[model samples]
Target: MWRWILERLDEQFPAFDVDRWWGIDDPFERMIGSVLVQNTTWSNAAKALAGLRERSWLTPQALGSLSADDLIPAIRSAGFQQAKSRTILRLVHWLMQHGGVGGIIERQATTEQLRSELLSLKGIGEETADTILAYSFNRPTISGDAYARRLYQRVSGESLRYKQIRHAILDEIKTWADLARLHGLIVEHGKVICRKRSPRCEGCQLRPRCLFFDHAKRLS
Candidate 1:
């Protein structure tokens, strides 16, 4: 199943890239933006991030200064704005208290170490932590949110939860590069082919091996 995905992605979108779409180079900024992206569309998240950048509030010091109220309006487009704002503000404060970005990474923190720290913040979860680790810190970790979980379940006919699915995929994925590429592929595939309902499987590269597609065809 995994190989099928790689083959399809390579064929259909030869130039498909990952890090570029996220538009976040800084590990710290990616961490913050990952939280902002929760349950929200990328465009809305980008808007909120743009607002943050406009105010020079993308860093710990600047963001830490915002009250929940002040921060909420800027991210209002990104659903659950007030709650997300609080989470962002609290996370910034915690990062600062812990000696900031250099302190966290320079310590050679384990994946679990960073995950625990991020999870301690209000809104950060396993998915968000893995995203921060992979997209930001360059950890060879798998990020499984709604899109990821749904796609894998549909393709593999697996009942694995995010944690289980994450471990399963990582175990099978041989290289750090593959992990990174697959993460982005799954994200893009979910958006374009494996949508929540009425997914466009016929046009999908993975249609040859996708379980959902096979099952639906068999029924028909």
Candidate 2:
């Protein structure tokens, strides 16, 4: 069913070019974005990214050198400036300690093992850790974010726990690229159709397979 949804999403949003999903192809930028987009829109996060890039603070070294106060103004667009700045600092320092994203990927080898360590970090929650693992480090793990949970709930008729949903998607996805693509497609679906309020279900390709739609139709 997850694969069914992914395939439909791929069809619905035909312009999902994995190579151009913001700066996801770049590990450093993705890490920054993962932090910046904690509870904000990607557009706002992009503004923060642009601010950081303008000052050459995109790199772990450059960003790590700055104090939280130094970063607050630059990432204010993303909101939660105080906390996110500290998080970015911790994340960059951690990355540097681990010899960067590539080094962690090569050294860890197992997503679960590395995920545990990442979860221990100050700002890295389950979703953020999974996102970094899947996109930054190029591992085949599900992010299990709000978008993912919402999509799964609408399609399957009920909400599974985060672990269940992540495991289900992980089972369906085989490669890191597919994992990234699945995240991208689901996020696009969330923003464009499966919105938090007043979802545009009439034109959604997945409506036929969506249990929520079926339930709504019955109620109507």
Candidate 3:
């Protein structure tokens, strides 16, 4: 079922690309975007990221050196400006303490160890940690965002916890590329088709196997 869903989503959204979705190529930049995008849309996050880049403050050392007040203006577009600024500062400090991005990337820590370290920080959570692990560190882990949860529940007709969903999907994904593509595909499908309100079920390829669609059809 997982493979089927992945294959169908790939066919549906042929141009889906995870790196493009985050609008960053550098692993560190991807980490920054992931944090900035926490409670805002990608468009807003992109603006904040652009602001950082324009000021040459995109690096850990540059950002860590700035006061939160200075960082806030640049990231105002992302909303929650004050809090996000503090979070970013804390993240940069944490990264520096852990031997900076290069050191952490080269460290022998296991995925779980890295995840624990990230979660110990102020704004980092399961999703963010997994995203850093998968995208930044090239680990075979799923980010398990809201889209993945909603789609998985609709398809399976059961609500599962984030860890449960991550484990289930991780079991099937063999490589880093597969993990990245699956996360991108699920998010794209949710935004384009299985949205929160009035999902486009009429011509959706997954309708035949979608429990939510079948139930809605019976009700109608």
Whose lDDT is greatest here?
A: 3
By TM-score, the candidates rank as 3, 2, 1
lDDT by residue (tens digit), candidate 3, 15-133: 88887776678988888888888888989999999999999999998998899999999999999899888888888898899888788889998888988988998888899889888
lDDT of 2 by residue, 1-220 (tens): 8778878888998888866865446878988998898998888999999999999989988988889999999999999999999988988888899898767867945878888888888988998888888778877888788888998888887788888888888887788887788898888889889999999999898998888898889999
Query: Which 10-residue span in candidate 2 carries the lowest summed lDDT?
Result: 18-27
Scored against the true structure, residue 159 in model 2 reaches a CA lDDT of 87
TM-score of each: 0.88, 0.92, 0.93
Better of 1 and 2 by TM-score: 2
How do the residues 65-121 of candidate 1 rate in per-residue lDDT, one tens digit apiece?
A: 779898888888788998898888877887888788777666677777777878887
lDDT of 1 at 137: 66
Tell me the lDDT of candidate 1. Answer: 0.79
Tell me the RMSD of model 1 versus the true structure: 2.1
**Model 3 clash tally?**
0
